[model samples]
Target: MGTPTPPPSAAKIRRTSSSGGSGSIILEKYQLGRLLGRGSFAKVYLARLLDNPSAPEVAIKVIDKAATVDAAMEPRIVREVSAMRRLHHHSNILTLHEVMATKTKIYLVMELAPGGELFAKLARSRRFSESTARRYFHQLISALRFCHQNGVFHRDIKPQNLLLDQNGLLKITDFGLSALSEQKIDGLVRTACGTPAYTAPEVISRKGYDAEKADAWSCGVLLYVFLVGSLPFDDGNLSNMYRAMHRRAFEFPDFVSKSAKIVIYRLLDPNPNTRLSLDELIKLSWFKKSFSQENLRSQGSDENPTGSEFLDSKQFKFMPRVNAFDLISMSSGLDLSGLFEEETTSSKEIRFTSKMEVAEIEEKVSKAGLEFQYRVERRKGGAMRLVKGRAVVVVEIWGVAPELWLVELRLVDGAAELGESQWGELRLGIGAIMAQ
Candidate 1:
């Protein structure tokens, strides 16, 4: 068979010209201008790709190595870049053009979304009208369905992550927490990681939760925030917020349309199994008639329209097709098997001398499912000095017959593993294991 056709290239917009000189050398090509925003570990700068002079202006995210405290975060960053590179959808999702790295920093060149964040817009407008909410919801669901169909779970889906183009189309960005489902894992993933306010109850409870379901819950929270201008569950304490989530203690505003309310209720269901599937969500009556055909056409006709316009249009339909090995190639370079190898050589063995610190232990265990109890041990003069060593957690899920599955979570100063009885408890994490 012939090679598949590549997706259409992104539209190019004129960039501001830069003067040539020694100081202008770096600024001439990338033209890294003023800092637009700063996050915990990174800073975003307005930039231009001089190689493609006519190409639209873009934003460059510079992740400082000195600022990143977590060693485990590097793999997650790589995974996000790889996933974005593989995705070629035409939604408002921010497109990653290239990844550049240096000894001190990593740079991500992305499309510059000028319309600002959806959160800012919401804050200014207080709450969106049903008609307005429906318009945005239609676009959001379409983008999310595209993500799910491609096996991508955008773990972070708050309004802050949503961007708007000049034409007022919403674009989803910030894939720091994104992961490909095909990545190898010890059995099931039990990590309780996500923004607490929008996190699903199952995730906060440390239950084995589906990433897709967790994403759906966040979407539900987003819809609620849009219509009501507040979180469904908020409290001074994290535990209290979690409790409220478990009890389903939240009220929908009276202004919400019946159809929108129905969809939100289904999306926020505690049971992942019962939550509205992306396919079903896209087919809902409200989504079907959310925006008029004229509105969609008008958005698409803009000179530099947001990709969401195309996604919301009938021309952009998501058709599910099964291809067994598509995800396999995406994770080719990641050697997870090495992580499972047991220490055979005497030099590889390390003796534990001290009990792991409770705070450090909690951080690692927090990522695991609550069904398992993790035990940490400090190794003497291994990776680091015993006094300043790291910790590792070995997790084994329970109830699976035959061979037991194991996962190791490493932290500074010690290591921990799931208790023997906890073996086989992870469903999705174990499902990620592939045959050699």
Candidate 2:
């Protein structure tokens, strides 16, 4: 895999020159206009690509190094960029065109969404009807499914992250905390991350939890917010919030649909193991019904409607292509491996390989019950090294014949083989293996 480009420095902060009474211009791409908004760590600007003058305008987000207090966040930012660059989907997710870095900031040129945030709309309306909520929920689920399938988990899923284009289409944005689903850590996400109102119980407990399941809980909170103008578990005190979440105590308004309520309950299950998986959510009756309706609506006369006709249409046109040369020029030396590091041995050796294949050993041990864990390393020559540890082979004699069984095979000390046990049946699967 290629390395990510370095972020910008603090000295590179440039003010945007106001054309009229507007603010200072930060980044200047060909034909792109001016800056729009500023966040804690980044700034967004309205810009147009030079190559496609007539193309729709895009919103470029620039992450200023000066604003990033935590040096640890730099890797996370790079990971977000790399992930976004690889993702290309249509259902309301922000389209990342190109990424560039100046001396002071990392710039992400993205498709400018015109409609603003769903938070603003929800605030204005105080809440949405069941049908409207269902529509938005369906869109959110679809986008999440795409991310999940690609091994991404948007740890922050709230109304604020949901941006709407001029055509009123909702798109997911702000992937700062997003990471691959398979990511593992010793403890829960330490950073008291995410909007407090949407945070899951496990997050507050400071216990390490699955990012995917945490995301699902947040989605459930978002659903509740869309349907009822407020969070399900909100109180004046932080302790109250934790208490409510711990008890899984949240009331559904009488107006909420039974089907929608069912979905929310499943998603908000306190036990991550019992929580509705993404696959299961996609198969729910509510999702099926809502998705079918959305498809019908899209196929009907509403097809190809402009931004003015629908509040959800994309207001600005996105540039078809981004200039990689420009990006490389702006970026300095970046450490790509810093963002994605696999588990290493005691010597801290980094293995870089494309594939690993494990061959089946030739030995038939009687099989009754089997449980084993092995560490498989991908060699440079496209081969796999299965480092097994201990194997417990047991033979039980029944009324008729003796049954052989393998209890637990702990692959820790070193590679070990079962003596006359079923080595052939102990086949290993190949893939990226993290020791930790």
Candidate that scores best on lDDT? 1
Q: How do the residues 1-436 of candidate 1 rate in per-residue lDDT, one tens digit apiece?
A: 0111111221222122322111222322465767889977777887665566565677777766555535545666665775564343334577675554444555666777799999999999999987788788777766776565444677888999999877887888877677555431432346666788988888766456677778889989898898889998889898888778877788887777788888888988878889886666766777767455444432443322223433432122221111111111112223222222333111212111113333333333343333333333222111111111222332211111122222222221121243223323332222232210
lDDT of 1: 0.55
Query: TM-score of predicted model 1?
Result: 0.62
TM match of model 2 to true structure: 0.64
After the best TM-score superposition of candidate 2, give how far the Cα of residue 372 lies from its true spot, in angstroms.
22
Writing each residue's lDDT as its tens digit, candidate 2 over 216-325 gives 88888888888878888888798887787878888987988888899888888878889887667766778666455443232223322212212211121111122221
TM-scores of the candidates are 0.62, 0.64
- Regions of model 1 farther than 4 Å from truth: 1-28, 69-72, 184-188, 292-436
